[model samples]
Target: MKKAFLALMAIACCHFLHAQPTRPNQPATDPANTQAPYLKFPTIPPFHLLKLDSATYLTKDDIKKNRKTIIMYFSPDCEHCKHEIESFLSNFNKFKDIEIVMATYQPFSEMKEFNEHYRIFEHPNIKIGRDEKFFLPPYYNIHNLPYLALYDKKGNLITTFEGTQKVDTLMNAFKEKKK
Candidate 1:
């Protein structure tokens, strides 16, 4: 009887050793998992980018010397980008006092159709520029389309909107100047 009990216990131990665990890396004391906080957009450094029409480029100085600037980082092929720009254009009067700089990571030729189709050039307050090789977007740590950044007349960033902002909200943000 003793021999039989020992033999059964040894077999069970062997079977348990060979079996795969359901949760291999987790400890019993802390079974639940936790995640890290989402990374918000970081403060961006001022830089110059090539414009489409003019031989001269745009830089942080342009924003400082002019009225407040609303930096619209968008993609030419993005429908959200189209909608956002269209909405802004439709209510251009609200932001007329503000300078609108439309920038993209795409090449100039690629953006030609969207630029022409939307007649973005028709708006006097608007300035179209190209990032060429995704330089500005990464510099701003922009991860999504239609990222809107509002900067004061001194080229210091006031606030950044991750996605599209309603006209009212956007206008409100523009009204806020650095103190």
Candidate 2:
């Protein structure tokens, strides 16, 4: 009986010694943990998406070298998404130099209509594409509709925005100094 009691006490002590305080998982992009290979994972992973033209595709390779890039992820039926695009177009002249890649995981037909409605094709600086493989949201751990991943001229990620980002903030991010 004493041996059994000692064994149970040992097990309880082991459990207590091994106990860990639980916490939410930090994003892979968070810099504190260098073990995560995501922060400098060379431009938000290699993505292959279909362009608005439907016949052609837009891959990570197509992104212009030595140019700033904005990867805008949106949905067709989302009101916030519409506002986000409008906000961008309204401030286009200021953002003309920055390359924009608008992407959607929805149907091709819907993206086509949205593109037409916005006359996005007229803006050579912007390219709209379809994320058919549905890779981005999970990669971004996205919880918002209009997510924007902003990269600098050197192809390094400056930061990311989840929802409706102010035009001024966007501009400031464009001008963000290297860290």
For lDDT, the strongest prediction is 2
Error of 1 at 90 (Å): 0.5
lDDT tens readout by residue for model 2, 1-179: 99999999999999996674434563444334334233547464587889876788898778778888899999988999999999989889877888888989999999999999999999987988999998887777677989998988887788888888899998888776453
lDDT, each prediction: 0.72, 0.83
The whole-model C-alpha lDDT of candidate 2 against the native structure comes to 0.83
Q: What is the C-alpha RMSD of each candidate to the true structure, in Å?
A: 8.7, 4.4
User: Per-residue lDDT for 17 in model 2?
Assistant: 69
After superposing candidate 1, which stretches have Cα over 4 Å from the reference?
1-45, 54-56, 64-66
Cα error of candidate 1 at position 92, Å: 0.8
- Which stretches of candidate 2 lie above 4 Å from their native place? 13-44
lDDT tens digits, residue span 48-76, model 1:
66776647776655653657778889888
Clashing pairs in 1: none
